[model samples]
Target: MHIQSCGTAIDVNFKDVGSDRDELLQATKKILQKQLVGQSYRLIILQHILPDTVTFLRMARNAGINVAKVFAKPNSIHKPSLETLVDEGFAVSCLDYGEMEGTEVLDKAILQEHALAVQYQEQLVCVDVGGYFCEPLRRLSPKKLPNFKGVVEVTTFGHNRYSAKVKYLAHPVISLAKSPLKNAEALIVGESATLATDLILRENGYLFVGSKVGVLGFGAIGHSTAKALRSKGHLVTVFDTDPIKRVAAKLEGFGVSSSKQDLLGNCDFVFSATATRAVEVADLKHFQNGLVLVSVGSKANEFDIDGLVDAAETAAIDSDGISCLTYAGGTKLKVLRMGKAVNFHVQSCPDEVMDLVFAETVACMATLSTDLPKSVLSELSDESRKEIAAKWLQRGTYERN
Candidate 1:
């Protein structure tokens, strides 16, 4: 089969590596690979280097897909897995979150990908984590970058970014951020974040039990985290800018804060799951003494770390992995994982849970390889998700039996 785009056609001849139903990732790979057997495309993925991600990449390669480049987030790169990718002959690059802004890193990557596409005459498909490719790709002329096919965005944050640029997009985007598969993963992520926070606090000689905890967002992760914390004996209050989410929290029996200030003032520890800058530098004044800030999302943008550092009289990391920022007025704020995702500091999502997301991502890639509407946003069909879920269930049952 030949998938034609931009006056170029690539022949796809993927042979079915028979189903390995006992292993989840392998089983998922087999099921999803059926969609790509008659399609071909090169992939450039921007993702964290977690164990599941490493497994996903190997699965993609085994399915006869050419993984051109993988841009690993610096904050979430697992060293051993990264070395494995290097040794396996996968072209890998790590993004520097400190020296370069997220979009800047994405822009540079897109440019390099454009060059590769032009030179190799292969259609390019970008798998984005944080919507980093949306704006930069929107600005590019289609005539100059013809080999670019589309993107598969996998985060709610990234989906929002692409949604904003939907009208101006120059290529198709398959969003799995808000898909049911991702929603399932978010539940596990939320539970993992809560556990990691507790473990980190204990390691730092702080008891989170009986503490007043506040969740800064009432999204899926926030809601799950709040419930998990409350179950573990923490007083959990929830806050959100969205009135609907605030109402949802209230209806769900969580103590809803009237304002961010109220939540900040009342809670001993605040978990920012807003995916954006939930707490800014100016909000530091409302911070009470000995308040700990935890970022539940992947990026450091959850809390303004640079602003906090600049405003602090002294910033230092103790023997524990926590960073303490002492303000001039004597308020000390402790940050876990230096404002990166705490769940990542521990194990990310469990391997089985993340396999669902990875499988969905691969399915999205297969969908992108087909001829689709251009310069618009799309999603994996319900039929596709159901198919993946069915395979997952089959694998799980087989493992148990």
Candidate 2:
């Protein structure tokens, strides 16, 4: 598909592996260019990343689209870019809560769509990540908003899980899966994740240095978790189904376990870093007593939470705010924030780190609005990496800009 945007034309051949991530980003830009024509479309952005969203809003201005309004968290509305976008006639409003907490904004955005359906018809498009934005929009009664057009759920989570759910919602819901630059952000954000985990462990009175720690999965999160635990003087062991990853971990000066059973059999604390079901009921059977299982991923599907509940003789939160599941065999498993992403659940990530993460997402979104080939997943081109890095390095401090 050939898309022409702002006098620049690019051929989008998703099937062609030769097309790098830059071209894919160009494809996204082209799509947005086409969609935002004649100041007719109302592009409602639930703004998270200030700088990147401003960058996209400028593109919207150049495209002549009506930059209706941007909804951001309450205290996150003071950025210079945000002021620039607002000064340029874009309505920038504040949503209640912090960057990660935008549920109220989702509600208000959907309510705005009701009037927009009657007034604007098909010219309305909402860009949201968490299912919160689209789910309610999808549920809006057709009787009220008969002209409601569609929604685009950007893949904020591991995969495009929300896309399938909204497919049956009777609207053209676009699910853009993992962004190309996700791993790059993952590597950088690992610092905050490590900090959150360390703080949580310490708050619960768990000794870090002397503990036998096992890191499950060898992806970005897994590798970072292992490195962080090792740095804290813990005896860290790595386990993964992939032999190459296990070998890589071994080369990093860490012990490699033959299987999940082996890791479970030896560790005092184990971190589930993979999105998959790395620790199943079968594997839990081999878990050492009084094991601490801190999952640094989402609460859903990362581990077998239901299975853990089923096998446990008692499930309760301890006095120190840690979740504990005691099994019939006198073995107990402790989880952080009930298996949610420890960093996110704790909200321990500093504002600047989240800004960087959100900025990366914005850059990816600028490149994702178009149709991308299903084969290629996450990536960061040299130019794109430099651009993101330049932004990161430019901001020397974590002040609310």
Alpha-carbon TM-score of each model against the true structure: 0.88, 0.60
Q: What tens digits encode model 2's per-residue C-alpha lDDT throughout 1-401?
A: 11111111111111221112122133234444443333255566664433445555665555665556666532223244444555567676653333324345555565675477457653555665444454555556646645444454443442344544545454444433344344444554455456666776777786556689898888776787777777778898999999999999989999999988989889988888776667788777798988877776433346777788788889996422478998876888887756655644333333344344444443444433343323223332356545655655565432221
Which 10-residue span in candidate 1 carries the lowest summed lDDT? 1-10
Which one wins on TM-score?
1
Clash count for candidate 2 is 2
What is the lDDT for 389 in model 2? Answer: 53
Cα-lDDT of candidate 1? 0.76
Count of backbone clashes for each model?
0, 2
- Report, for every candidate in turn, its global Cα lDDT versus the true structure: 0.76, 0.56
Deviation in angstroms for 299 in model 1? 1.0
Model 1 misplaced stretches (Cα beyond 4 Å): 1-22, 98-121, 318-320, 371-375, 396-401
RMSD of each predicted structure? 7.7, 12.1
